[model samples]
Target chain A: MLEIKEIWKTFNAGTVNEKQALRGVSLTLNEGDFCTVIGGNGAGKSTMLNAVAGTWAVDQGTISIGGTDVTHLPEHKRAAFIGRVFQDPMMGTAPTMQIIENLALAARRGQRRGLRWGLAKAEKDRYQELLSGLGLGLEDRLTSKVGLLSGGQRQALTLLMASLKKPKLLLLDEHTAALDPKTAAKVLELSDKIVAENHLTTMMVTHNMKDAIQHGNRLIMMYDGRIVIDVSGEEKKKLTVPQLLELFSKVSGSDEADDKLLLS
Target chain B: MTVFLNALPGAVSQGLVWGIMAIGVYLTYKILDIADLTVDGSFCTGGAVFVMLFAGGANVWTAMLAALLAGMLAGLVSGLLNAACGIPAILCGILTQLGLYSVNMAIMDFKASVAINVTQADTLEKLLVSLRFVQGSVKGDFPLWRHPILVVGLFTACLIGVLYAFFGTELGSALRATGSNGNMARAQGINTDFCKVLGLMLSNGLVALSGALLCQYNGANEINVGRGAIVIGLAAVIIGDVLFSKLFRNFALKLLAVVIGAIIYYIVLQAVLAMGLNPNYLKLLSALVVAVFLSLPYWKGRYFAKPVKRGGAANA
Candidate 1:
């Protein structure tokens, strides 16, 4: 479970370009809760995830994961309990490393790194099995450089790596946005499967209204750095894109829907 | 031809020393994606520390260890300046280099320079003399080519071997990942700041080790020995990577290529000198070599299209 209390974040504060990215945004997720966050541009969706991930210290408030106060922990320290995937496919994995090597790093997260031979035989076999489950043929290419992988394959591997140890919270920041629609669907399906199998407490942010509505058990709409609507269970299941857009228009007091968000 | 062949071993010996420095440069520039200028000063710092320690009656091995430690300290300072203080890596290197100017002077006992007396019965010469049979078989009154070239070459080979083994380890893989993608490495719980510090320490330590070896081999430690070292190291790494593209994918082979690259670079310079070229143009030659080799990958990617493709496009 994760708890965020009155988290506030601002960029370039006290400058001409000052922007209040997150304005007293507060939300909580219970264990095994799979939440999809829908927002238009600058809705603090990514900022909220980053604030939890400890990418930067929030201007105000506390973040707790599994009852541990991680508000003051730095990014690397918080990494022991939190796993994150970024918007860019390239941002989630080391391109130059072999697939198995990258998995070994993920597997060994928070362990003391030493001058030992990399990836034991049993570990390699385990990684192969995991990769095979992705159905991406990556099991056969364990030794190939990850840079050569397609965007979908890389994102899938990143998702697997992020959840390899089943951290307390999993943060997905528009992880499939850069992929083709077909690939995106596959990745989303894979994401659902992984989250279900692991029973992961997940927060996935997306701009696509349909995806936001269809995938997760709980769906939340964010506007101006605040959660405007939080719907779940059968309520979330029956929600439509048009109804969600109408809700957003009513709450945010904006008649104009972002074209990109609507089109996507 | 005989003279060149006679100098071959010496060139190789010097090349191995430079190779070590080139590998150090590679760690920062290639592996860590950081442009570090600390190498020039660190190389001299290593030499100066070794010479000063040796002058103070330390054993050769102890002196070398001291030099390595000193270099690690210098690297740590640079890393701290970069990671802790939020200074850019290049600026950190420059600051360290400037600070080393005084530190190096102090290491030389405030003397402008220090000359290790080869005539003195040093451990290296004593070890060589003790192997009379090996020396006598090759040339009477000779000591099995126990010059700096042989010692430095053998030492470099061992160093490269150890580095190769280290880079193949799990920790090394993590460090490499840190270089390739800092954010992802962090997300995996890798302490990238610590990795950066450790990497720079290893890099500058190797550079300094090369410097110490050069001092012992050349029988002198000059304040200016580290001058132009960064350029030379860059030249060797680029040349090596260009010549050994296939080999460089492996960490060990990449290290070896850097050593070979340094030797080849020197051999070409020697050849040009032999052709009556002015020695003053050596810096220009070094620059041109680096530039040409660095551009090679781009040129191949951009201009080396197949004739079939060209013809097919024309027909279309």
Candidate 2:
């Protein structure tokens, strides 16, 4: 469950580079709701996800997750309730660290790290089991440096890490955008399986319209820093590319969809 | 050649003493990914604190402990400036290092140097390690166990063992994660700022401990004793990494390589001095050596790197 109320964020205010990234945006997601977000460049889709993640304080409005206000909380503090997978595969895992070490870090999310040995003998079996489930054969490379993994593998590991502690909400910001078509599809499929298995409430920002349609229970399209189109339940299940494009044209008052939105 | 051979023991002993400081630099430089300039000041701060307390009748261990604490305090200031005040990491270290000059001077009663009255038999007898220990052991006047090389070698071993264990702990792993990927660390709920500060404290504490030992060994703590200390520390770390990174994959062995690197650095310096190099140019030579070694990786990547063929023919 997540609540965001009229959040406003502006970057570089009073400067020539000023841009309004978010404009009085509000959205709510019920428990176990997986929301797919779609928008062209500079449409604030990623900005909205970042606001919920508390990457920075919004200029106005409040946000809460699982019934607790996190508007004033810092990014790391808010991490207790949120799992994040970044657009860049390198951003989500420590490259110089080992695979198991990264997983161990994720296991202790929201908990104080003390002087105990980082990897307990008992937890190794559990980690190997989880890695095997990824079907990437990472279980055999527990001590291998994560830097050596492929981009798709790293993204998959990041997804596992994000869901390791079962946060209240998982945020995926174009997590597969950097991978090749085959790898991207694989990672997306992995994301769906993981989210479904965990019953995780998720907000996934994607540029691909087909992916936007093919995944998640609810769909929202952002335009000009605001949510221009939102459809859910039976309405979303029956939606197609043409209908979504027509709705975007109606709400955005544009004869054609943005080239990126249409083409991507 | 005979002179160089005769100087081997002293060079090795001095190298072992400085190896401790190099280990401290390794923690911040390699582990925390910070180039903390504070060690240049904190090194003298340790020596100053040790000499003042020891001359004032404190026990040897108490004085050394005070030295380590003084160094840790210096690191804390730099850490707070960088982490809490959000000053740039390099600037924070520079500020703390500059401030520590005045503090070190005051600790030594505004003197340019402080001596431990090593001419006094009681003072000489009380020192844990000294230049005299090397000669006295060689001459069989003192027990071989009292040799500076042996004592300092044991110190380095213990330090490496402790660091290896600490780095394997949960808190240490978090610190490693902070250095390797700060964004990932924060998302995993690690307090990265806290880890950075803690690392600086631990690093400077060891540096100061080395400085205290050096002051005892040299018979005096000079105001300029710590000048170019960071360069020496960097030289040791870079040299060790270049030469032994492949061979020493284990954490404890890696630390051992750093100490060995320091020893090798001193031995080379001794050899150059034996070949009639002017002592005044020593710092310049050290600077150039470190600068060259530091640029090797960049040059290798920029100029010597070859095009790679991936999963196909070379032309393809």
**Which ten contiguous residues of candidate 2 chain B have the minimum total lDDT?**
B307-316
Best by DockQ: 2
Window of ten residues with lowest summed lDDT in model 1 chain B: B126-135
lDDT per residue, candidate 1, B32-138, as tens digits? 88988899899999999988877777888788889898899999999999889999999999999988989999889888789776665544453211222233335
Clashes (N, CA, C under 3 Å) per candidate: 0, 0
| Candidate 2 local lDDT, A184-255, one digit each (tens) | 999999999999999999999998888988899999999989999989998999999888888898899886
Chain A TM-score of each candidate structure, as shown: 0.97, 0.98
- Please give the distance, in angstroms, between residue B291's alpha carbon in candidate 2 and its true position after superposition: 0.7
Residue pairs in collision within model 2: none
The TM-score between candidate 2 and the true structure equals 0.98
Candidate 1 lDDT, A178-223, residue by residue in tens: 9989899999999999999999999999988888988889998888
DockQ for all candidate structures vs. native: 0.62, 0.71
Q: Which residue pairs in candidate 1 have backbone atoms (N, alpha carbon, C) closer than 3 angstroms, thus clashing?
A: none
